[model samples]
Target: MPDLSSFPRHSWLRALRQGLSSIESQSLGYTSPKGLPDARTAVSDYLRRTRGVLADPQRVVLCSGATQAIALLAHVLRNRSVAMEDPGFWLHRMVFRHHGIEPLPIPVDDDGLDVTALANTTASTVLTTPAHQSPTGIVLSPARRTALLEWARAGNLVIEDDYDAEYRYDRAPVGALHALAPDRVIYLGSVSKTLAPGLRLGWMVLPPDLVRPVVSAKSLADTGSSVMDQLAFAALLRSGDYDRHLRLMRRRYLARRNYLLHALREYLPDATVLGAAAGVHLTVRLPDDCDIEDIVRRAASRRVRIDPLSWCYTEPDCAPPGLILGYANLTESQIDTGVRAIAAAVGHSSQVVPDINGKVAPDSGP
Candidate 1:
């Protein structure tokens, strides 16, 4: 989730007004299932300029957020199961299952998805977040990136979920894997994290061969996404307001991330933080004796909502005790309060908290 408090309402309104005034009356009717030409072109330009994605407007299919995009792919590629990062986004796995596409869990390590483990899977399609692995927040190492692409070249498809690539604090964002081999990679991205999820705006830059089937699947899904919304987003992209808003939010989120890190050090000194380099949330690895369920329940009692790390895994028992804390939606004081509450919840643990020495400790267990 993004900082909803700082949503560019005025900018969006201006874009909406411009979109309505400039849109053709003919466009109000059923447009192409691929999406409005302007929207697709705008997305293509933005992605090409920022993420190094090899995007063609003709190959870009806009949908109602990444959720719809995933569903469409599952429908088009339902012949076989898809390989997913073991501690990946849980909701995506559910979406695949809903569309009758079983997801094969592939282990993720500090270097990102284990390409070796993935190579062993029978699934032809693998969904990955190379920029910043979901929940874990580790960037895919150069070696792993090459290995994964090699695997894709061997008659496989890579679903690159460019998740949380916009808010990198430590360095410039990594380039999209799609640029290396566009035909073998299906790039997924949305304003859900940057703008707002309610907009339900997302896009897919598909392989030439997959484009027609995906467009067909999208048509069967909803006849295409909302045209007005798409046009509005196009206006935002064209006018440069979207980039300005991102610059502003990046500063804000960076501040919040820093404060959260400080709060963790001060209040929850025993906990180890991971994935703070990018994304709106960070993972805090708790002591071994800390019961994650009990900590989550106790934190909820304090009116602090926190997601246990185990919830992101396909098999909960395999996940280590930790918490996924989001700071994008909370103020500095709220973050401090929330961290204190979580610290209280974790107070029952008797295991020693090792000094992380200003580095994220590597996980020793699966």
Candidate 2:
């Protein structure tokens, strides 16, 4: 989730007003499940410019959100199980299961999903977050990226969930994986991270072959996404308001992330922070013996909420103890208070090691 309080309400309202004033009455009747033409074109232009996605408006299908896009794909790719990252987004697993498509869990290391493990699976389709792995925040390495695409070229399909790739703080965001193999990769993205989840706006840049079937599934699911909303978004994109809003949010989120990093350094010096270069959240690896459930309870008692990393794993008990903390929605003061509370909860459970300077050392990962 992004900082919902900072949603571009004024810009969106202006777009909506402009869109409503000019929209044809026929457009209000019903729209193609592939989405309105203007909207698709706008999305295509934005993605190509920012993420290096090889998107053609003709191949772009708009849906309510990434959730619906997943559901539509599940429906289209019926009877085929899909490979997923072990510590990936749990909701995606649930959506796949709901459509009776079982998900095969592929292990994720520091370089993102293990493509070798994925290739070993019988599944022909795989869902991945290559730009920034969910929960873990590791980017797919170049070698793994090449391997994944090669696997795709071998009659397999890769679903690239390019979620939250727009918020990199330390450097420019990575290019979408779909850019390398447009025909083999299905790129998924949504406004859930940048603008607001409530907008329920998302897009799929599909392989030419999957477009019609997925669009048919989308039609059966909701006839089509809200046309007015689509037009409003198109207007927003055309007027450059969307890009402006993203620029503002990036600076805001970066400051929040820094504050959280500082808090962690001051309060939990023994913890190791991973994937802090981008995204709204970062992962903190706890000491081996720390009781993560107990930490959760302790933090909750102090009015601080944190997600246990185990919840993202296929087998929760087997996961290493850690916490996934989001600072995007918190103020600096709130972040400090929350970190202090978490530190107090951790107490003496964390085993601290001194560096050469004899000070407790803090560590970070790329």
The candidate that wins on lDDT is 1
Q: Estimate each model's TM-score.
A: 0.95, 0.94
What TM-score does model 2 achieve against the real structure? 0.94
Report the Cα RMSD per candidate.
4.8, 4.6
**Which regions in candidate 1 have their CA more than 4 angstroms from the true location?**
349-366
What tens digits encode model 1's per-residue C-alpha lDDT throughout 1-366?
A: 788878999988999999999899999999999999999999999999999998999999999888888888989989966899999898999999998877999999888999999998798999999999998999999999999999999999999999999889999899999999999999999999999999999999999999999998888888989988998899999999999999998899999999999989977877889999999999999878889998788789989999999988999998888999999999999998888777766663432222223333333331
- Tell me model 2's lDDT, rounded to 2 decimals: 0.88
On the 0 to 100 scale, the lDDT of residue 14 in model 2 is: 97
Q: Per-residue lDDT tens digits of candidate 2, residues 1-366?
A: 689899888999999999889888898888798999988999999999889998999999999899999999988997776889999888888889898987999999988899999999898999999888988889999999999999999999999999779989897778888999999999999998888888899999999989989988888898999897898999999999999998999899999999999888877887899889899999999888888888899789879999999988888989999999999988998898888877766762443333333344443221
**Which runs of model 2 end up more than 4 angstroms from their true locations?**
348-366
The whole-model lDDT of each prediction reads: 0.90, 0.88
Q: Which candidate achieves the best TM-score against the true structure?
A: 1
Model 1 residue 341 lDDT score: 74
- Which pairs clash in model 1? none
Q: Taking the candidates one at a time, how many backbone clashes does each contain?
A: 0, 0
